[model samples]
Target: MRKNKLSFQERAGSLQEECLCFCEEASREAMFQAPIELPEGFVIDPAEAVTNVTWNADSLSCVSERCFIETGPEPDEIAVQFAVRLQGTVTLLVSVSPVRNQYGQGNGAVSVIHSAEIDQVVYYSDEPDDCPDFSDIRIENLVVVPPFYGSPLSVTGTIVLVPEPDQRSYVFTANSGDSTVSVIDTEVNTLVSNISLSDIPTDLGVTLDKAYTYVLHGNANLVSIINNETLTVTQTTPLAGAPRKIQFETGGEFAYILAGGSSIYEINISSQTITNTFTVSPAADDFALDPNGQFFYTTNSGIWVVNKYDIKTGQLIDRLSNLETPNVIETPLIGDFAYLENGELRPNVVSVIDLTTFSKSSQINRLFDGLITIVFSDDGTRAFFLEPFPENLTVVDTAQHTMITTASLPGASDIAVTPDNQYIYAAQPDDNTVTVYRTSDYTAVSVIPVGTGPAAIAM
Candidate 1:
C-alpha cells in the first residue's frame, strides 16, 4: 500500500472543519436537552483541538484520560471557552466529556481512533488589553466525568462580573453593651474592625455613597459620624435631644435624625449642623423612606398610628390609625407599597399599605408578639421578618400575600437580607452570634460570632 502525504494547509483546514462540526453538534445537544440555560451575554466558542497531538490509533493507548491543553499564551488547561460582552452577574452551565477511545476492543477494530475527555473547567474575561492574570480566572469544577458515551457531564455555577449596586462590601452592627460598632467585611464574612464610641450605640445608618456611618449615641445627645475609609469618628454633631434612629437622603447630602420628643432634624453632612427640624407625633419610634425619597412613613410606638409626611416640605400627607403598636415601617425596593409591622399587642400583623392611595391595602397576620424588624428581598417579591419571645423568622410572599414558611431561632433579635437575595442574616443577641440562612432552601449555612448585644444591623 502506498502512503499519501498531506500538505500543511490541508491538515489545518481539516482540523478546523472538524472543530466546527463538533461545536455545532455539541451546541444542538446542549440547547435541546441541557439541564440549565446558558447565561445571558455568553456563548460557547468552538472546540479547537490541539494540532500537535496526533489522532492515530497507535497513540490511543498512550493518551491519558486527564490531560492539560493550553488555550492562551500562558500554559493553562481549558476544556471549553465562553465569550461574554456585557458586565453583570451571570451563571455558567458547562458540559464536559469523558476520555474514551473511539475504537472498541474488537479484532476488527478501525485503524483511526479519537479520544474525548474533559476533567476541569476554568474561566477568564477575554477583554481589555491587559487580560486578567491566571490567578484571576476561577476554576468552577474539576474531576468531571461524563456518564455515557458522547454525553458531556454538566455543572452549574454563578459569578459576578460587575459589582452590584446594592451588593454591600461591608456591614455595620451596633453592639450596645460594648459601646462599639463592629465592621464586617461581607466578602469574607469576618469582623474586620470595631470602632469604639463614647456612649451606648442605639442605631446605625450608612450613607448612600458609603462614605460615613452615622451612629446614634444613646442618651449622649450627639451623633458620631464615623468615616468609612478612615474607620474612625471624624466628627460629632450635638443635637437638641438624644437621637434614637437615623436615616440618610438619597445623595447623602443630609441625614434625618429622629431625636427624643417629636423632633426630626435634617443635618447637613458637610457642615455637620442641624439644618432643619420637622415634628411628627410626640413619640414616633421608627421611620422608613420611600424609594424616591418623597415621603417618610413614621411609626408611633405608644399609639396605633402611622403618619406619612412629605420629605421636603414636612407636611402631613396622610395618617393611618387603628393599628396596634406600629413600631417599624419598611418600603420595598419598588416604592409602590409600604409594609408596617403593626398589632404588637394582639393579632401581630404586618399592614400592607398602598403608597399611591396612602391606605391600608391588606394585612399579614398570625405573627408572635415582640420587637419586630423586617427586610425585603431585592426584587420586592418576598419579605423576611424577625420576632422575639420564642424567637422566629418568617418569610412572606408579597405577591401572594401569604406566609411561605417560618424557621425557629432561639434569640433572633435582628435580621438583614443580602442585596442578591441569596442569604439572610439574623442576629442572635443572646447567643452572641449571627446565623446565615440560604434563601432558596431556608437552611442555616453559617454562624458568625459578633460582639455582645448585637442590637442593630445595617448592610
Candidate 2:
C-alpha cells in the first residue's frame, strides 16, 4: 500500500473544518433539547485580585487565591501556596488550620483549607466508643447504679448533628417534606443557628472547608448559597429545567447544579451568580465526587455508565453509561467504585462500579419495595436504604453484596450515617420521626420524633 502525504495547507484546512463541525453539532444538539426559557444569570469575568494567589510567609495563611492552598508541618516539607484562576466572583474558602499537618508530618495528618469540615464528618464516630460504659460495681444479678442510660430527655423527636469535627456541624431533620440545614456545635451537639433561605431546602452540598453551604430547592428553580459563618443566605443563583441536585468544585470556586433535563448550571460562589453552563442531560437525581476533585459521576436519561466530568471545566470527560434502565447513580467513595442504587421500582439493587475500567464489579438486587436512598457506612462495607409504602431500613453488606438485614423503621423517607459511623439516622416525614440506630448491632439506639415530614438526611 502506498501512503499519500498531504500539504501543510490542506492539513490546516482539514483541522479547522473538523473543529467547526463539532461546534455546529454541539450547538444544534443543545438548541434542539434545551428549554426555550434561557437560564436567568449573566456571565462575568472574575476579578484578578480575587483570583490571584497571595501568600504571607510569617502568618502561613494563604489568601486572595482563586482557590485555597494548603500545607502540613513536616521538618522537610516546605510550605508552598498555589491557587487556580477561576471564572466568576470571589472564592469562598473555609479552612481549619490546626487539624491539618503543619508540615505534612503525621501518618493520618490532614490540613484542609476549603470545605474541610464536610469531609471530616466521615471521620467523626470511627472509633468503638459507642459500647456501654460500665464503671460501677454490680451486685449478683441487678445493679441499680443510677441506671445504665443517662436520661431519655424524650427529645422533641431526634435531630441528628453531623459534626464536621474540629470545625462546624450540620443539622438534618424532616420537620418539613423537604430538609432543613442548621449549624451545630460539634462538641456540645447543640444547634447554633439555622441557615435561613427563602426557598424550601430539598438537597444540600456543603463545602469541605466549612465556609459555605449549597441548598437546592427543586420546586423553585433556584439555589440558595449560604455563608457558614454568618448562617444567612448570601446569594440566590438560578438553575435550568428546575434543579434536582447540587455539587461544588474542589476549590469551592463554583457550584454545579444538576437538573432533570440535559443541562448543568455553573454558579460562581464568590459573586453568587451563574457564569457558565454545560450539557449533561437526563442526569439522575443524585451524583458523587472524587476526593482529588478530578472526577464526578451521575446518570443521564438512564443508568448505563455513570457520567464522569472534569471539575475544572464544565466538560464531559467520560461516561460509564453501561447501566441498564432504572440505575440510580451515586457519588464515588474511597474505593475506586461508584455505588449504584439499581433496579426499577419493584426490584431495587445496588451495584458497585470499578472506576479503573468503568465496569460493574458486583451487583445485588431484591424484591424489596420502596427503596429510596442509599446510605453507606463509614468503611463503605455496608449500605442502608429505606423501603417505600411501609417504610423501613434495609442493610446490605458490600462484601457479600447482599441485603444482610432489614430493620423496621417508623416510616423513613431518608437516612444519614453519623460522621463517626456509630449511628444511622432515618427521617420519617409521614409520622414525623427520626430513627437512630447503632451500625454495629443494627439496633435502634433512639427514636426521636422530629419535624412534620422529613425528606432527606445528611451527615
Query: Scored by CA lDDT, what does every candidate get?
Result: 0.62, 0.50
Which TM-score value belongs to model 2? 0.55
Question: Best by lDDT, which number?
Answer: 1
Question: Compared with the true structure, what per-residue lDDT tens digits does model 2 show for residues 70-122?
Answer: 11111221111122111211111211111213343332211112210110011
TM-score of each: 0.60, 0.55
Tens-place lDDT digits, model 1, residues 1-459: 011223546545655665421111111001112232223333222142111112111211111121122221222212222222222112233343221233322122111122332212122222223222222223222232223564433332222222223434777888887888887777878777767677888888777677788888867888888777546676777887889877776556888888885788898887877788988864688887776778788888686788889988889988888777777788775548878877756646777888888888898755656546777776788888777755377788888668888877667767778879888777766776777778788788788888788888777
Worst 10 residues of 2 by lDDT: 25-34
| Candidate 1 TM-score, C-alpha based | 0.60
